[model samples]
Target: MLTSGRKGLEASARGTTVLLAALVLASCASGEPEAKIEHLCNVADASEEEALLRGILRADDYTTDINNRTSRVVEGLERNLRDIGPAKETLSTSMCAYKPTPRAGSDRARFEFGWVPRTSKDAEPLLSGGGRFDANGAFGESNYFQTRLFVRCDMPGDLAEPSKAAWLYARASYSFNIGRTDIDQAAKDRQTALAYLMARRVTDALGCENKPLEKPPVVKPAPTP
Candidate 1:
């Protein structure tokens, strides 16, 4: 005859295995699937910093210069939108296309671009969210900062029209107090980022990359982002 102890041990082992199997199945059902990750910009290269400083600046002269360019791009973009109204055959555009001016001996943000009609490139975006203030300065007992920014993006051209592109853009002015030396160059950078964010939101809305980005994605400043 089989011993009672042996039978008891066998029964416990069976119970444990059943419980483990149930737990595993439950976990699989409840777990979320892994998400695909995309790296936007690499922060290590200092060359990009120089490029940004050269191409992007917040001085009044640069602001005016950028705004002027923006106007031309916007005109083109608005026209494309109008033409594409209810046209089901046209494929959407997602990014801007313009021939950048050659970099010369350090010029003020006063640069010119040859706008290209209806183009799409998955260029890395520097702007895509609301303005975030980060620079801090000193004012005797208080700290403050003055910032100005202008940003613009040319929307991808209509797939139907190879000669057209759209535009989305933003501008920012900020003077604030943090009263801390801890404030850094990021303050200015955030303002710049705000402009790009506006443009990105607009491009995303064109339903080119995927479905259009959600409405009112960013207007005012959000967190450090």
Candidate 2:
């Protein structure tokens, strides 16, 4: 009887050991799926933006430098607005220049990446919601890079009317065009990527609360009192 009992106990211990080993193996296999490069490329507006900017950076040494500076600025903006969500608009009574009506919601934050304006020796505003960068001027004469990125914010009461639609209106000189073939195809590829990324980023940035601003005061402000 003693011998039989000892044998049974030994078998039980061995079974327990096997079970534990299996559990360990299962745990080792259990981990978050690795991020897909394509998915990552598509996820953050920043990635798309960066890919586009990097194209210009990869264009030529000069363009690369400009892109690098722009990248830094975008990084800073992303950090600042990481938690801010979409803005809502309301109409104000002002008639001369319309104002956005205010609506409130949870902040919607996203990442963006792009080249700085081609004219900016350093960061400076080129438009109310944009900046200028000179990739060649900042980087060098190689002309490999040329592009910019702008992180746009849609504040409450912004885009109060159809006139406020987001659009890319380029006023190019007659000479201005997509680069000539003599330019590196690779660099041109980057430009294409940058354009797509910029488009995507802008579209993403246009998101706003559907609700219009609280009704604007119909009466004009009493003749500037």
Candidate 3:
């Protein structure tokens, strides 16, 4: 009877050990994907540029939108360039659109990034292509400044599949009412800086080959006669 009881106790101990191991494996399996997603989407650190924007806009706080799927948008408030009496409600300071799983072809990837090949004779490039990056900008009716950047990068995993690629799109804008018809140089600089900063972060997270965005992107100056 004593030997039988000892045998039963050993069997119970073995079962409990097996159950614990299974639980641990289950936990790891469930957590691994989420951990990868978190790393993939991590871009929380933009404090210096955020502070610059806040100071320029005289805003106390800013709001952020981050998700595992598509994009991140951050908005803030600024004092109207024309009317200093009241603050304008919201201005989109930065936007970042990422494509994690690009389609099969390079053209498909560009289309996914919202650019399609131009079929018309008068069509123009969405972004002025130059340097190591592509960029463009314009002044709004309010005379505020806006700029955008585009970059193509190698996808993080499965280097064996060289065709796998990703794209990062970033934009920054300032909204204000002013009498001037041209873009505000100071505001333009700030917006461009922020857009580049956000794009750099995305590339860094993805471990892209063309990352670091070493040079400041340029918007070609108007033609000289």
Candidate 4:
């Protein structure tokens, strides 16, 4: 009787061990997909940054010595936006032609950044009415294979009054050529990164109370042409 009772207890212990192992396996299986999704959405690396800068500089076929100037112009715009007060009215700057030379084609890259007071009756209505912004508070549009990204973040503070609210906005676009019906995923990713970079700078500078923008997803490489 004693040996039989001992055997029964041993069997029960084995069953409990097996049950615990199964539960652990189930937990891991459920968590695997989320881990993979996070890995896939990793932030842009050095290569993507380099690609965007080079692409912007060589956006058009007409070659000129405006590469340095283009870089400086972009940097200056960011600085100006960051140095200004959060409640300031709309302050915007754009770079249309990097060089003085006339271009044979309309293909070009443009970078724009600005901020608008949410109190403005005219601008507030247009921005608030648009339901197109995504979870990251950004919207993108593509035309003629050109990718454009717009990002906005409303300032957070005691300014509950509509008259006191303000928002920061950034836009970036690059057009390779005209008449293409399909958009390039890689280009879109780069522009999205650029826009987020600008938005982050301004938000940090102004000390906005909003959360950081979500990282752009990694896009598969476009097929070779």
> What is the lDDT of every predicted structure here?
0.32, 0.28, 0.35, 0.42
Q: Which candidate order results from sorting by lDDT in descending order?
A: 4, 3, 1, 2
* Candidate 2 global lDDT: 0.28
lDDT of 3 by residue, 103-208 (tens): 1121100001111111221112333221122344321111143354545544444531331321234444333312335545555555555556555655554456
Clashes of each: 13, 34, 0, 0
Q: Could you tell me the lDDT of residue 170 within candidate 2?
A: 13
lDDT of 4 by residue, 72-160 (tens): 44445445544545455444655332221234454455445555554443232232111222325454443333333344543444332
Assess the local accuracy of residue 196 in candidate 3 as a C-alpha lDDT between 0 and 100.
61
- Provide the TM-score for each candidate, comma-separated: 0.23, 0.23, 0.41, 0.41
Best by lDDT: 4
Tens digits of per-residue lDDT for model 1, 1-225 = 111122333556677677777777776798944332122111122343234432343321111122323334444445555564322222222222111233223322221112222232211123323233311110001012332222223235454233234222222223222233544445445434433333343344433343232232222433442
Distance (Å) between predicted and true CA of 196, model 1? 2.7
Q: What are the RMSDs of all candidates, in order?
A: 21.9, 22.5, 19.5, 20.8
**11-123 in candidate 2: lDDT tens per residue?**
56677677777776776688634321111122222354434443333311111101122233334333333322233211111101100112112211122332222233322
lDDT agreement of model 4 with the native: 0.42
Give residue 79's lDDT in candidate 3 (0 to 100): 16
- Which residue pairs show backbone clashes in model 3? none
TM-score of 1: 0.23
